[model samples]
Target: MTKNAIEVNNLTKKFKDFTAVDNLYLTVKEGEIFGFLGPNGAGKSTTIRMLCTLAQPTSGSAKVAGYDLIKDSAKIRQNIGLVAEKMIMYDRLTAAENLRFFGKLYSIPKQRLEERINELFQLVDMQEWKNTQINKFSTGMKQRINVIRALLPEPKILFMDEPTLGLDPQTTFSIRDITRQINQDGVTVILTTHAMTEAEALSDRVAIIDHGKIAALDTPENLKNMISQGDANVFGTKISNLTSELVNKIKSMDVVTAVAQQDDYNLKISAQGENALNEIIDTIRDEGGNIASVTNSNESTLEDVFLAVTGKQMRDQATEKATPVHHRHGPAPKARVR
Candidate 1:
């Protein structure tokens, strides 16, 4: 079996009476880009902080980059680069200066540090702006510099929290490409993001976290398949004025299982199969309901999986309260492991 690059067992953290993380377990393989997904208050940042050795886990044990999270935190820190969600760098310093500062902090030799800085500038496509002060940089540029600074030490593993949060589409694509390149260079990456599309695009595997625990963990394809399996053949029609009588009449059809109104005009009805669509239409027509447009709106996606599991969209769940809890033993909950 391949050895894991990072391992967490029963990891937990609490702040006062709130539990931020509860019995979280995870395993990231060497050279894999593991997407750690969750809403804003879902403890993603807290977990990354512990893994990066910036915050100790309140309970449980973890091993990162072959170093114990508690007993060998210093060693762990040396082996992993961290890019926090918030951009953190000196505004007065030039991008190149910031890289140099981080290189020195990591204790890179003077000669090697200069070479590494040059490489990082090229890696992040920031060589042209190397001499420009960070205060003059755009949000995307600052994010690129933040990542470069974290990578200065050539760590074996990287922890990135919302790395592309505020970036434009073009810049986000660039960052994603760079992340893939880094992983190709044999570095393991642990990333946290609320963007399902990004996770689906980049992760070798993804962990869906919610309520301070994992709701699902698997490859993106597998997670999406879970939602697909739950899908029923459904037909949606837009009517001028949907009413309770019309809804009940549609639900009473032989093939229709449920009927829901989208608004005053649109009605969505779930049916058993394709044949049911004709039956639904016949029934609606008999009732003198005129169909303006019909379409299938229940297509499965990563968003559907998230919604099915969390009962909310990733963006909406970000504002919920987050409580901290101590870690629990054993593997994390296996929702959709396949």
Candidate 2:
């Protein structure tokens, strides 16, 4: 039988006037990658803080690594390693010096720690850079060192909070591969990330949280299947003569649930009802839209499930820089949100 790595029962955290995590119950299986996903300010950090023994819960109880959250927090801490979103290391220290510092704090023997450090450096293929100062490293290089620093203690469970945030595509893929390798080596991983693609690719089971509660919990494919079995349908299309007036008219349709303009020529639509496609196509035709192509797919993505469950976009679009487009009618129109 598979033993649980972490378990919680009605875990809650509150400020004087606000509740951050509200009566949450959850469990993570041993040696599996569990993805915890939520929007910003959605209690993910608070829950992690509580489990990591950095913050006290307002009520309820949890067992991390088979130790009571309150009664054995030190034991729990000893059995878990945390990789925070922000890299934690001294910029002035060389990679070897930083690892030695952290290993000493964990009370590892000098000879064993040195051997382990060398082994890890080789594992990440960074042995040649071990003597280099962190200040001289690029963001990706620094992140790699940060990850190895957390592993020095050889904890049973690893809590990775946005380990690949702000990384280039190549670095992100490298980090993800590293995560899989770690899990294969018998470490249970709990990953929190905003990237739905990352979550789907890495997680064996995913839990979507919103407003301090679990909105849905299952394997990524199962969650996507929930969307596929529903009445909602997603469509992608390109229009040769797309305009703001046509876009607005489609948005006003009773069948349309959400509309996003991908580029000057392309649009992604989500709608329900039996005649959703007909209604949408008729609207486009009425508005003098020349349809270049249309694709209706029953296959649902993690992003699609996220929207259906949370009723909001997965990431904050306001922070992303929109590409400038040349529209036939006037200035480029901003993409509409549900």
Candidate 3:
């Protein structure tokens, strides 16, 4: 039987009058790359902070790495690694120096630490640059180091926050390959990202959070199917002489749920009810739109699912309240595992 790496139940966080993570319940199975996606200010960061033991929750409970969230925080810290959005390393230190500094804090034995450092450097293909100063490295190089820094402690679970936020295409691909390799080595990963393609390609299961709550949770394919196979109808059309007026008219249609301009001549639309596509075509003809082509594909992207489920809801207004929680077990060691 597969074990669970993380379990959360009604985990809530509030700051004064505002709630950040509102009654969230979730479970991440061992050895799976779980995706945690949400729009801005949707409490993604706040929830991660609480699970990482960087912040405390207001109510409810959780178990991370089989340790109670509140009582066994120190144990939890020892068993997990964090790769935050920002790189955590010293600019002046060389790659090897930085890794050594962090490894020492974890109190790894001298010989074991040296072997682990070499193994990690080879895993990320950074052996040649081990002695090079971090200040001279490019963004991608720095990020690669950041990833391995989090692994020095040999954690069971890894929390990666926007692991590929601002990298070139090649670098992003390399990082993603590394992520898969790490997962294959039996490290459970909880990934929080805004990139739909990344989440769809990497996650075994995904949870979409909106307005401080889970709006949809399922496999990427299942979530997309909810938009394509359910009541919603997705249409892709191109007009040679597309105009803003025509786009506005389509948006005004009672049946149209979303009208996005792919370009000056192409539009992706979602609608509902019977005869909706025929009505859309008729309206385009009446409005002098020069039809180029149309396609009704059964396939849907994760982005489409995200927009369909959370687009119509009012935009999130609550700011993540960063309240520091005093841990009886003491704060996690700085840069020890992140």
TM-scores of the models, in the given order?
0.77, 0.86, 0.90
Would you list the clashing residue pairs of candidate 2? none
lDDT (tens digit, per residue) of candidate 3 on 61-179: 99999999999998998999999999999999999999999998888888999999999999999999999999999999999999999999999999999999999999999999999
lDDT of each: 0.79, 0.86, 0.90
- Model 2 ranges off by over 4 Å: 239-254, 257-267, 282-291, 313-338
Give lDDT tens digits, candidate 1, residues 282-326. 877788787888897655456556655664322533332333323
Predicted candidate 2 versus true structure: per-residue lDDT over 159-270, tens digit per residue: 9999999999999999999999999999999999988899999999999988788889999999989877779898998999999888888878888776767789998787
lDDT of 3 at 263: 79
lDDT for 240 in candidate 2 is 96
Worst 10 residues of 3 by lDDT: 312-321
Model 1 lDDT at residue 261:
56
Candidate 3 residue-wise lDDT at 304: 75
lDDT of 1: 0.79
